[model samples]
Target: MKTIPTLSLALIGALSLSACQDKTAAPEDIRPVRYAVAGGNAETGGARYAGEIRARNETQLAFRVGGKVVAKLVNSGEHVKKGQPLARLDPSDYQLDLAAKQAQLAAAQSDLAQQQLNLKRYHELLAKQFISQAQVDAQQNGVNAAQAKANQARAVLDASRNQTGYATLTADADGVVSQMQAEPGLVVAAGQPVARLSQDGAREVAIQVPENALEAVRAASSLRVTLWKGGAPLPGKLRELAADADPATRTYPARIALPGDSHGLQLGMTADVALPAQASRQLSLPLTAILDLQGKHYVWVVDDKTLRVSRKAVEVGAIDSDNAAIASGVRAGDKIVTAGVHLLHEQQRVKLLGQ
Candidate 1:
């Protein structure tokens, strides 16, 4: 056998190295993706959230001024009429202040009366040429000054009288007392919640909705509220939806307005609020599956046999924070890439991450 040249051996070695690299080339990456079957969410009939019955006009009742509470006249759950006295503070000091203001006002009025008499006498003296015109003007100025002081004292007396009334707490509207926080001896600051007053008015159901369901709940035309006390579901309308989410719960607080009768719904009663579902048989997908490109909505449809992903434009109807209803462009049985859709392209091989 003839020995090969050194350059040819080197050339053969390079070819062998290239072949090995080709054999070890990274397998075409088949990205693993999380997916969901269309219309697979079990709560499709309606989304029910646990909630509580609440007053549409609940308010915190507190005193305008700080004082020792002398009495709490009502208990929780007691119905009260407008202008009814609910509680009272010690009014001894307030009354004393009012009396002092009265005394000040009385003294000021007496001084003003004396000043007016002096001005009258001075004007008569000027008319008889017994006093200079300048003296009459001076006396008139004194009367004006005294009158101003009397008016100020009168205003102060009125404020002092009002303060005495502040010692007693009265209901601003007809309502039920849902809670009482002050007792006979409790000293509270001004504006401290002494009681919770649920004004008699329209009733409501208070519920917390997850971020994903916020929009759907807000857009709901009407809902059914079932109290834990076991009665027929009450009809309600979406009244208020919080714009921001709660920090601790990460959920939005929503209130559904019920009629004034609402079958005598009691405040703080546990309840269930059910949002109306979408149209019959309409498929919905997790909001994550939606892909919006150039103002058009799309979704990644996965082929079962080939495990390949194909981007398809979809008709997106109502969309909540959690899911979007599909009007067209996909079927009920089609598998959809729920997550990692933005990272995918047309006709890409994929692996299902167990549903």
Candidate 2:
């Protein structure tokens, strides 16, 4: 019984020693801390918009007469000058018709010549009393009839020639061939588009603006367009605003004319546009500072006194080439985590790198 009491005393002494060791352990060993620096506000200028580049004029090249295509001289993306032959239909039928009309014209001319001679002879005979007045009148009528037939034949010849010319499709303007819908041996109808041509001229950036954003866009006086390829921003003027919104997207179409030569620009190229909202001093930050969880967007901000992280929900406005505009949720003098936000949580302690 005395041995059991001694063993119990020993166990109690060991438990007290373990409690003292736990109190002496370093706090850093229990929870590790990381340092994060706050991001400084960046100056933002305007709202950046994205849109597609388009040519000022586009046309469809098609044959004027229906026939089987004999040859397609041009392909898509081929640059063609005005009057260049784009395609040709079979002209054999048209050529035969023209030949037939020519032959008829020749016969009509011979008949007209014969009628003229007869009418002259009749006039001379009537002058000498060799023919009666009725005979001369009949001869004159015959001459008029022959002349009318000659005129009809001439018209038919001209029409046949025109039809022959119509077999060849030509470009109406200098442009790049954007599409080719027909090939050799394909039978195409008159006025059916065989190719699409995009005329070279002033280029515009076409953008679809949400209906709710139209008021703000109209209120702005000017906007700047930045080519994705990088250079000086081209000054833009609002040329047109659609009267109605698109039924499918519920957005209004807006077009901006870009000043300067658009020689290098091509259709479907993407461009970035910047529109200035009300000019006011606001806090802007790099896009890296923004974070997303589920569908909500937030930013990690540093507490001035505790040096701990605070998650703040922010309303983001527009994004430009480098930064994003913060409409709400952040203010000046607040230090925002610029990097390593993925490793942070609410109320997490952090040590400043420099401090």
Please provide, for model 2 over 122-199, each residue's C-alpha lDDT reduced to its tens digit, 9 standing for 90 to 100.
Answer: 999999999899999999999999999999999999999999999998899998888987799999888998899888
Collision count of model 1 = 2
Clashes of 2: 0
Worst 10 residues of 1 by lDDT: 39-48
- In candidate 2, position 178 carries an lDDT of 86
Candidate 2: RMSD to truth: 5.0
TM-score of 2: 0.70
| Clashes within 3 Å, all models in order | 2, 0
TM-score of each: 0.68, 0.70
Give candidate 1 regions above 4 Å deviation: 1-43, 279-355
Model 1 over residues 1-355: C-alpha lDDT tens digits?
9999999999999999999999899687699999888877544456889988888898899998889999989998999999899999999999999999999999999999999999989988898999899899888899999999999999999999998998999998999999998799999888999998898878888888899887778778889888888978788888888999999999999888887574567678999888886555668799898998999999999999999999889898765568877889998889999889889978899999966
C-alpha local distance difference test of each model: 0.88, 0.82
Worst 10 residues of 2 by lDDT: 29-38
